[model samples]
Target chain A: MSLSPLAIVLLAVTLLLGVGFYGLLVARNLIKLIVVLQILAKAAMLAFVAAGYGQEHMGLAQSMVAMVIVADTVVAVIALALAVQVRRHYGTLDVRKLTTLRG
Target chain B: MALWTSSLHPFLWLIVIPVLASPVVYLAGRLAGAALARWLALIALIVTCAPCVLAAQELAANGAATFTLGLVQLQFDGLSLLLAGLALGLGTSVTLFSNAYMRGETGEEKYYAALLAMIGVMVGLGCANDLFNLWVWFEAMAVSSYMLVAFYRDQPASLEAGVKYLVQSAAGSVLVLLGIAAVFGATGQLSLASIADSVRQAGATQATSAGLLAAGALMTVGFGVKAALVPLHTWLPDAHSQAPSGISAMLSGVVIEAGLIALLRAVSALLGEGDAVARFGQLLLLFAALNMMLGNLLALKQTQVKRMLAFSSLSHMGYMLLGFGVAAYTGQSAAAQGGMFHMLSHGLMKGLAFLAAGALLYTLYVAKGAHGPLMVNDLNGAARRYPLAALALGVAVLGLAGLPPLVGFMSKWQIFVGGFQAGDTLVALLVIFAALNSVLSLAYYAPLVNAMYRREPSHAVRLGAAMPPTMIVPLVVMSILVIALGVWPTLIAWLTEPAGQALLAGW
Candidate 1:
């Protein structure tokens, strides 16, 4: 069966989310985690843009997705800055070793 | 026409004030020393608070109002009002406290500036009405939070917690975004109300139903990471316990609530009137129960004060979940009311606890003249030295443990009664367990009080003249409000009722 454009976009988004989440769960490096999160954000935006397909009205979905992209970029930048600090201080990005906060 | 013109759109001011003030706070940092930076942050927050208070008043008086931002709409409803008020109130108090709290610390400017920006983002998230808009503000809040977490750049643990928090939060945002995308794909709408309407009309097709359920689950887990719910809550104790005390207060007190509100909004829209949503609610109930049990049980074993509070926060999140579970399962008016009430009350109470803790830490730092690695035992016999700070701590803990004549008990009562009224026997049992957990919480809380009051004086327990009034005043104010709300819960109920009504209005 042929899929609609929306369906294809939806499937791609599903893949992206799945991959991103898998990477998030399995990845131990802070930088790689950030990259996966960015990918995940893009997937969500793609799904959003695709949802507005076939509508004759204004590009509401497009603009909203654009806004989300901008927000994600900002978050990524800040996360990277924090990660840089972590690397400098901790000398490594492995999450398991950062357990100085147990009660 | 003049009368109407004189009163600007309440929603407009709510959004604009924070957006406008963020840059000013950032710019002000460059012009002056830490003193000016603190004042600027405080003024910016005060300005931000004005609009939120007005919007809340308008919500109380005229009901929920919607203002369009392009195709997306921004609404100032009772829920918005309640969340915004808590965010702003805590934001203002914390700004004041941090002003003095961060004095003499290295890199103070960046700390205050980032904190001010975070407050703006949090207030915006609280006020945002549409799904897409909520996501934008939520990300904004996350970014700022990551910065604050890593503010102490020299501390390895602080940096580590910041990285962990960022990675986890970023992943969660992605999941939420994908869920939003899926809902948009199915419904062709980004507005929460429109999405709910389309989902309701589409009925339960295998693909659509599955897609929505998957999306909902993804969003729930995504947000669960931020809410510090169990299983996904691993980051919280590390993040909250390692950050600078002022930043810790903001993180525990207000930042996590942003995620919780987002999840609640999404769940309410998805499950407003559907069996699928109801099933989803059941899943949430199970998660809530597990979170409640694990969070408190874990806290009992912690030796660190900050880490203990972190675990207690996890338990509190479970209590908030109890409110959400009842509301979702039965959608009873009282249950919904209880959920919103708990959100408001928890925000204030938790914010107070963290700030008071920060004040105690500050006093300890001044007395010891030490720069780093302060331990819990360092706080032995603190009460005789800093009676006022100890009083603040006592009130905050008592309130947190849900003792009567304090706000915590009032909020818990609403949630417990609502849970029982909804006939969720398991949840009611969980609520009872939660109440007992509060009593057990006293075990942990009482020590700080007892250590301060009864233990032999340690050198670190002595007071210093350097403890600033700015920090002291906010803690005292919050402590007083905790008691005031307990004696007169109607004040909070009045605010929460309209917000709950607004949440359920379209449904």
Candidate 2:
């Protein structure tokens, strides 16, 4: 059976989101976790484009994606800097070990 | 009578002024010093507020007006002005206080920059006429505040908190983007008016209702993460406790409230009294009840004064959500008004409390030349040494606990009355629980007040070390407004009613 473009895009989103969330939940390395988060963001960005592909909405969707790209990049840059700081402070990039602030 | 010459609109200026001026404030701080940066940011915020004040005047004199530029649309109505006033007004106060609180601290120029930038972004979110623009402004606020949270990045705790805040909020942003994409997909509209129109047109259609429900759920979760609602609030304690007190004030006072405003705007605009909207509202009521119950219960266990305040902030958000949830569920304008009013007053009182927390820590640093996590016990007998700081803290605590003669009591009272007026027994019961939660909150806050006045000197506090006038001035100003708004409830009602009407008009 041939699938619609919406179905294809949604299937891809589910796959990417499933993987990203799995990594976010299971990844021990902070850097890898951030990378997974980026994948999740990419999925959303992709959805924005796919939702607007058919009609006269492509340009607006593309511009929105571009803006979201800039925002995601800023988050990445800061996340990387924070990762470095975390590594320096905790002596590891391990999420399991980064538990200093507790009740 | 003529504040607008066609080119000038307060909604545009409210967002534009701070955003364009943030880098200049940073540069000024760099050139002259943190002190100058502080004054410049204060001036920038006050200047930014001029448009809102003018807009309010114009609205009073003429009537409600709408302005649009490209993708951005804003209402120069009472709601936007009230939120803008709180943001810029508190922004000015917080900036003034930070200069003295962060005296001689490194990277302060950047702090002023990020702080000022956040004010602009939040103001943008306030007046943002479209859901897409709202998400963009909200994300900008999140990113700037991430930097502010890690202002002390060298400290491991601060960096950790910053990272946690960034990661969680970034995820939430992605969800918000997805929700917007879904909204645009289903309705083919992004503007608030258009979205509302489309949803109204497609009322009761299975495909349309499904998409709206999904969008509502996704957006609610997204904004809930940012608003520090019960389940998604793990990041807030760390972020608030680690950020310098000046930043903490903004984070607790306005940022979360901004998230609430955006959520309410989206729900009001897009969901438009559909079955889906009512379902969403029910879910929100459930979340609000949980937020109020568990938020206060959890806050009781936090020892770090700032973290405790952070949890208290979470609990207050629950109360605000209770009002909003009731409004959405019952479509009551009064409930919406109460929710918005709660947002404004909470911003004022919590800003005061967090600023006082900063000053107490600063006083400790002054006496001992160092500081660490500020505990409630750390503030013991501080009244003897720093009477003003202790008194400020005491007043903030009482106000937060819903003591009368303060803005907090008036807002809380209205929130419940609005809930009961929703004419739903469950909502009325929830409001009663919320009222009891207020009393429950006083349990934790009371000891802190007593500690300030009744306890002996546990930690050494300086008797005379040249108190920082910059910090004290802002505290005094905020305290006066807190009481001023309380005594003159009509002033706030004048603002809240029109805003409530704007949202109610959607229904």
Clashing pairs in 1: A103-B302, A103-B303, B78-B499, B79-B499, B383-B452
Candidate closest to the true structure, highest lDDT: 2
Retained true contacts (fraction), each candidate? 0.86, 0.59
In angstroms, give how far residue B17 of model 1 lies from its true place.
2.0
Give the TM-scores of the predictions, in the order they appear: 0.93, 0.95
lDDT of 2 by residue, B86-127 (tens): 788888888888877776778888888888889888877877
Q: RMSD in angstroms, candidate 1?
A: 2.9
Give, for candidate 2 chain A, the lowest lDDT window spanning 10 residues: A47-56
Docking class of 1: medium
lDDT of 2: 0.82
Error of 2 at B388 (Å): 1.6
Give the chain B TM-score for each candidate.
Answer: 0.94, 0.95
